[model samples]
Target: MAETDAAPSIALPPRQTDGWQMLAAIERVLEAERDQLALWVPVGFGAGIAGWFALPGPTGWIGLGIAAAGVGLAALLFGGTSRLGRAVTIFALAMLLGLVAIWTKADWVAAPRIDRPKVVALTGIVEAAEPRPATATIRLLIAPDTGNGLPPRVRINVDAEDLPAPPPAGSRVAVRARLLPPAPPMVPGGYDFARVAWFERIGATGRALDPPVIVAPDGGSSLADIRTRLTAHIEASIKDAGEGGIAASFVTGDQGGIPEDDNEALRRAGLAHLLSVSGLHVTAVVGAVMLLTIRLLALSRRLALHAPLPLIAAGAGALAGIGYTLLTGSEVPTVRSCIAALLVLGGIALGREAITLRLVAAGALIVLVFWPEALAGPSFQLSFAAIAALVAFHEHPKVAAFAARRDEGIVLGGARILLMLLASGVVIEAALSPIALFHFHKAGLYGAAANIVAIPLTTFVVMPAEAIALALDLVGLGAPIWWLVGKALGLLLWIAHVVADAPGSVANLPSMPRGAFALMATGGLWIVLWRTRLRRWGVVPLAMGAIWSLLTPPPDILVTGDGRHVAVRDGRDGIAILRDRAGDYVRDVLGEASGVEGEAPALELMPFARCSADLCAVDVSGGGRTIRLLATRSRDFVDIRAMTRACAAADIVVSDRRLPRTCHPRWLKADAPFLRSTGGLAIRIGSGEVESVAEQVGLHPWGSFAAGSR
Candidate 1:
């Protein structure tokens, strides 16, 4: 009876909310925006390529097969069924395509492995010549020479003082040299020089024992000849080596000519991007050409009325981009920029949007498909990050609001542009900071400020001036233009010096973990790609990455790949480097990783250490852990005996020579055999644990070949 009276009011738990509704909302949004979201295909494909590279050895092939099968199954199950099904299918297909791309590129660029170091007479045609401030390096494409088992390409370093002139590109040369496989990372979790070499088809690096003898005169293609002549002319035009080097770099992308100190200055000031041939350079050149073409077409009434002006202008821009790419030697960055420029021009020619996310995606996809290995390189990462960030930021509502304001006058308009430049620079620096940290272990704190001043000057003055000068030089009328370029370069150099000299211009940070970087990158991409308020979620991963990077523990000891240098972390968070001789590269890598600037002093090189002629003993205490380390540079029996005596009481022993059998348990041999296998070793003193570069990277074909042999 009571229930009958109240059959009325059964509330059913007030219709409790379910988590599935939120997911349903997401699905609805994704379905409605499938076309816009499809841009992620190339991104996912690139990620899959990176994954393939990260996989261990032949397991990559297995992973590829699995992905391909999954894609096929997905397509079979959901072909044209629903939006969600299509999205899943697209994802699987993209991953499969990525793996296929990686496999194809790897196979296409594969070179014969070098088994051992050998002194041989090498005869090959020089592909390129990069003259460093301290040495001259020639890139030689082997001509199936008989004596040595050199790979397709080798980089040979000749003493600059002894060899006054480097062999020009396309010149056949003969040289006596000791050829070794490309050097691996200097420390665990460091740069992978071997991987870079593999992708570049450079199988080995060598030091020339004698000056190269030119077997034939330069016989390069017309494009190469022109580029060489242009570079030579620019270098000869400017008297100062630094200025000339900067001019050449801007025009031809030959950075090797710049001095190390100058390069460091640029890096510290965050102007190093200007040295690379990238989107900025290509855009400047293409824009100038397009503007000129449009103006010329406008002058002709018939052409303006009847002809497709935009198409003609776009064609001119495309030609300019092609020329610039060829001038820059078609480096990866240049190629990427050229592709993007061409895509944008093609869109203009077709009456579509000139610049859009699709254009960027297409360019990225092309690079990924052709050179999947570039996904690992800093230049590729930084270039894409900068452009993507710029595009995303400019497309944002806030940026649009700022840009919509009418130009009051030249003064106000200039101010607005300056503000926009500052904003864009900030956005780019923020986007690239994680990548730079992950790769270089450092960030330029004042990058935004430096870029604000540098970008406008470089884009409007330096690049355009250089391009004009290049054109004029073909007609022997480039002297004045060259002077103008030199002036702009001088100003750029001055800006670099001034900015880099500022206190705290460079921020040295320990390397960020790969997982943390991946997390941050995902969030960054989300923020850039998503068109909803949910994009704010990206901040969470970004903050988490920053915290993770700050908290990452620095290695207690860093051993160089060559086994000749060891950096031990001291109690004061300082580094004590133990070495028979100084190595700037090793010092810089260790310093950046440990957050130390410049070089560790001689006293700090082996603090609290007792050293004999060949052996050095040190006790390192830090983070509530003590480690007894004994290092010896000599393989002499006397030094070995001293090392053995010390090893009995030591927790770790690093030696250039093999240790005695008694010391085997605690020994980390830095000999050729040990380094060949391990590349480099980073030891955690407290746990007596080790991280090997070779082991962490696993047994890839390229790295394994070098690691397997002495």
Candidate 2:
């Protein structure tokens, strides 16, 4: 070899057409992403879980068969030397694992559900209790006694007046409550409480007929009691309900005490994350502990010289994170943050980079393996997406290089930090907006700006003050710290209010099409996961998704699953409902679905509608088409002859009762039975033609009321 070192004898392949060139390019791209292979596992796994949820009904054996096939395929590919083969095998296995995991979890958590409304006397342990100011009710998680003919768990709310305070968890209690199956979505493409209840093993929900009588008082100091007591202590210390509620939520994750107005304000201001103990809160706790431990240890020179400071600090941080997670009730967000925090600590102990995209992937994978159903929830999606965006933004070559530069002075350094925070906020907002819109149909326009002030205030001032105050309260000397916490929270609340009150601060839109959301999500992931130049192509889909979303037409008419409330879109970008005096819950849901930020006006009040005690006729101008609609104002019967004539002239007819056969609408007949089967209805009309009819409920466990019927 030394005799000539034949200039790396290279064999040139023969030139080929565009097809071969494209294949070669793809292979090159795959090679470039070799280091990123692990990052794709959670994606594939989540896709499988999503597929399982998208199925119309349960298919346990099919999932198992698919997983088995994957195992076999992986085995076959194990012998292959090709990188592509290895990648495919790994992805296939991950997908199958996800499918099997969710299926198994679903089967395991399956429990009997209330088939219909019933009032029964039951005694059970109080697993949890929460206050509901809006409803003037106090909710309790009841763990039924054995052989009660009830599911393992049921939740019922008693009148706030009936009890002095919420019963402590673990207290055995008896109550006569009217139990009903979990409520399905009130509007098309709305939140599904039934599905959530099914997974949590909550068979029924209702209001108590009488107050719960405590059979056995809870005297033991358990974790649940600790949380309850801490919440009570915080609420007692702070006289202001709003501040105290926010403070309690920060420490104990008991958000029940927060007033509805304050909660709405926080959500609109985009500062709502502070109320939830997630990555920010967890990191604050861990970092504070680590800093204190390092400082305290450094004071001891002899011990400091002999001890591994980073490893010791990491261990302390890990412990603090775990304790905080448990204290906060181990919510999905908290659990994910704790998992990520532990991963970071492990990395530190191993002398590796502590934060990276791979860290997010590992945490998500761990959660999916254990609770696969979480993959379908907004909490999981938002949590992981936000973290991944931050990591990816900082990992960019230019950004990382700039961030690594040494600052000449404190002012410059502080400025640099502020700039980075602002930039990170923007990136996070961009990544999370699509998800928020998909789930909630609303996105905060100024969340990034609001976060710049709120996040630092919370992480630095509020959390530390609260933690110290909590510690001092144990010794009855946290008055000053509590004051500081209140002041800091007040500032945060002020910032939120300012941002939320700004005109156009929030973009409320109709529910986005599933296709558009999926496209955006995929594009966002591509941009976050890949480091290659090819990632720029993700913008194409992002743009396409935005266009698709913008093109989606809002429904001209909305009918609740119960047919008790109805809304029709006016020619202007507003909606008018059947009942002008609809309850807050109904009005709010209807408004959001119709892209109206606040209360929608009554159809009778609109110029295009006429209403009476029992009937309402509407003329909706949708896309230059005047859609005639008739709906009942109440369940009271109308003259059959009159109803038939009105319905025959209308494009859509909706009522709470069955309609006569003589009454036929040209477009749709959304009566009680139809609404019951569909859950909710959203109808769009264009140019005198029925454009689309979207139903809220699908063949899912939560919405399938007929299943397990009594």
Candidate 3:
């Protein structure tokens, strides 16, 4: 042995080269993580779609064209020869395809834009009718009369003093109303209602001057008509307004009928997801159907012996999912669930196991490719986040070991399932917390506990009963089932109320910057998608995001788009609202953003504010700088004089009235023209900086109608 070692003590070619070794290592890593890398393809593509939407004006088109050319050149040069080069080509191609898909869809669905506000006669079929608590606030969807050069659809608020009944869908209606383009966000970084309306194809919104006349009676039953009828049936069976409204929402997705108090309670309790027909409900329906069908088929010896049980069950599940989606109006979430269900069923039919991550990602890609705008919506974001987190956690060896354990005893199995549910809820709550805070400025503190109680009741008892009732009603035998469904819903509502009434149930956090959310999402995805120990690095960015959120300061001042209300931050970090009238959406947004529950009582109670009937003045001092603001809507000459004097002493003057020529340079006028142009305003006192939603988001197709008016 010693002689053999001496013989082999020759040069061994310097251990291949570091560069070649590194390349080989990288190749191995790519081979090992090919599936993991494939999942990120859709993520990058979605980001590209969102980027196109975020770009200002026509710049997106130029960027898209460049990406397309780059993709083509990259494909030609590499063609999958080199792993690194292939990755670059794939990314370039995804970005290019995303831009192309969005551009094409946007053009195809583009509707006539409203240029000005005017009274017009609208005559079209009533696509939907939502009856509000106040009879006068009924919402009507009127398809625009063809060749009117109006948008394809217009949402009108009907003011009917006395009506026998609400207008049913499928009825032709005529109304005379003053139509105006949808309003923009009420403050900087606020919710963009106009953007939502644009995607809905609602070109304008208006208040009907008089009751809408039914030009023609209901002609035929459409999906909307069926939903309306089902909603009415559920409401009639329940008898209690709150419970019935909730029941109808679960059954038909008609949440407009729910009482405001009930809606708020559900949201505060973190049970709002139950009211929406999302992935949970869809999964529940499909699973229940599959289980029941399999059991029934097992009872039939001839069929069970001859047929493929898994394929049959999957087919039944797919059918149930499709039914639920159609019955629920085929919303974005419902559509996403249907896609996932179909993909899973297809896998089963092809004798392959369904991978949760791939299924979830495939569903998302399908939805985004068809409806690119949905990529920006909260439903899409939250749904995908929840599923991804669930899949990631469940895929872990520890979690899988726990889930795989079986207990033949019913009690022990029940306990195990409960524990698993609690664990899943915790994971989902953690994953969605930042997103909820960013989008809604609040997160339910007890969401995990609330979901533990609500999910089982909604999934096992309530939704199944609802599905059965709908089917029974097809044969005119649904009343008893509907009654039972109503009782189950009552219990659910009671749980919601109790949970929502708990102290500190909702955490009101200031809205974090978009960049912080990007960081958080990246870290979360990194941890979920990577298989190596390097995944631990994700905690660094996540922790950094949390720190950034904690350190970020709330806006110093918030001005409503209408210019009639303003909220200033007080010394106690509470919001001091200076308004003669209640600021509806604007007030709520500011209250949540400032972490204040209610409005500050008076100017004297405020940190730096003094007010009179004619004018209100605020002075904020921070970071060795002072910002003085004077705001008023009073038209009285004395009030105007007082405002002018205050303006002379202030750094920023806001008013609906015209400012004197001398004060023009320092004034931030909130006249009709200004409000129409800027939407809303946010001010930073320390830096004396101001931002408007219009300027921050810029003019895009969603806001094009309002921009056109400007």
Which 10 consecutive positions of candidate 2 have the poorest summed lDDT? 689-698
lDDT of 1 by residue, 486-574 (tens): 88788888889988999988777765677788788888887887766767888898888788878777778777766678887766767
Can you tell me which runs of candidate 2 are displaced by over 4 Å?
A: 1-18, 58-80, 133-135, 687-697, 705-710
| Top-lDDT structure, candidate number | 2
Best-fitting candidate, scored by TM-score: 2
Model 3: colliding residue pairs: none
TM-score of each: 0.91, 0.93, 0.90
TM-score rank order? 2, 1, 3
What Cα-based lDDT does every candidate model obtain? 0.77, 0.82, 0.76
Separate clash counts for every candidate: 0, 0, 0
**Candidate 2 TM-score to native:** 0.93
